[model samples]
Target: MSGSGLSSLAAAMESAVQDAPGVRVQTDVLIRAATAIDHSGPGSPDWRARVAGAIEELVAAGLVECPRTKAGWDRRTLPELPHWVRRSAPPVAAPRMTAKPWHHLLHWVPTVDSERRLSSAERGLLDAVNRWLPAADQVPVVPMRERSWGLLGDDKALEKLRSGRLFVPGRLTLELLRCRSTWPPVQQRVLGAGTWLIVENWSTFESLCTAAEADGFDGRIIFGSGNQVGTRLAALADKGDTPASPVLYFGDIDVGGIRAARLAVTTAQGAGWPAIRPCRPLYELALASPHRLRVQPASADTVSWTTAWIAGELGQQVAMCLTRGEAVRQEAVGLEILGPAPFAALVADV
Candidate 1:
């Protein structure tokens, strides 16, 4: 056998692909196996270059074919792999245990990109959690300070932690530090005496802020910043010395909005807040608004469980929208919908 690292890697790649059913091998599968025997750092540039080079060599030699797409490599139809290399022993087959709770949690969390690539800190946190998950009596806790390498100060990691992932409790020890010098020049209103309201759309957020300020309502509005809510909202709602107050989420009447509401409530509840719910009046208004568009439903494929968690009327409306394949934008409500009086009326009893 050749002594070159690429030679051994190529051989292992061939053997693994040959042993696999249908001669199919995913990029991650090959890279992971190569990492086990290749003796390279997990995400080092040199290691990635070596893997890429070996893959390209295999493609050139007609041993593998990775079709290209406009976006990137198309792994779906990766061509048949050749069985040209020999291995000393067959790959081990282990009994498949039921998926651990963390496995399902990861599916719900947005830790990785479309390519399933994690950042250095995210990978560190995930690996550490995997090691301690089985032995964890309760939620496995990690300090957020610069104690060791893990996803602590990382915003995305904290957001995911707040999403009710029980085995990995990173949100408890996390504190987001803000320096006046490094701030992004965005000014957020400080609440004097009010409940926190998370607004998903930028336009709606601005309108609500204006309305709340003018109406003299005791409601503090925070922007959810689209799909990635980040850690600011969670920090304000969960980490402060102020008393925990009710949380109300107001977004579009579409599936996306419902999902956002669900995430907001779950994160708040996980942080120990007791009263978190969607603004019933705003949600109902969107559902019943006559300004609905005929656009295709964004999340029509799967029925969501948000209906069970929200108020009966609002939840039933969300369920009805899904069943009828309807999506209502927040713009349907317009700026006038949540004017001072209406906004005050929305949360008056809560």
Candidate 2:
């Protein structure tokens, strides 16, 4: 090889070693590249002979050490070039395993037809579920009676699934499993990663999600389950910085509204995520909307997180907002406000 050609080959070899850890040079790869490029470009007619000579010099100079497994042309040794030889080179770390989990990027549900072997990440998740669930051994999934997926927190169920001690009636098909009522054939979601926005009524939730999707909201929207909202926040914080969007809370403008806000903030804080904040424009905007004076019911009642928030004037204002005739939901004006460009900007703002 010409001087420049040899230099180029040396550079390529050094890069491979540095970029890929645990991957020593493979003999076949070097032999192929060496022969393919020999005198093909820039190098002299005897480039193959010349390359062989330079490689030998590199080995002799102690800049490249031959692997013990190789015979004659098994040039699989790492080039102990500059950074490769330098003590100052930052230790090539094992691929950084984000202290935060990467379940968002990984999908590992077992399906009936086939078994796409689980990734290391999925196995780790299964292990954690097994360890945390007290009764993960014999989980029962009867038709959910209560509105919420109340059994989700049951450690036994989680553990059983995690340990492979029990299998779902079907393969755990989707990454997310929603709970719903048998009556209207409704479905409410249970778990998710990435981003989730919560809204009160099912209609608004559906409407907003559609607008979000058309506007590119996609899988980021969720039902108005303050308790689950809390759950999502806790899960998120436990993993890392919550995604860019906050746990948006769109509820009626009343006691329930304040309660919703209170619950959101409380659950996030209780789960050790104080950084999570209540999303805006629900009650605060209801206080000004034309629907502000309409009357509504207070029967839905306060949940644990909301009970503590119904104290001060701010709390009273939230209660007042809820007394509307028709729900003046974010879904109504979302096209004007949360259309693709605006909603994306809002997510960025958070």
**All candidates: CA RMSD (Å):** 18.8, 23.1
- Poorest lDDT segment (10 consecutive residues) of candidate 2: 78-87
Question: What TM-score does candidate 1 get on C-alpha atoms?
Answer: 0.48
Global lDDT of each candidate: 0.53, 0.41
TM-score of each: 0.48, 0.33
Q: On residues 290-327, what C-alpha lDDT tens digit does candidate 1 reach at each position? A: 76555444332122244444434456566556645577
Please tell me which predicted candidate would have the highest lDDT against the true structure.
1
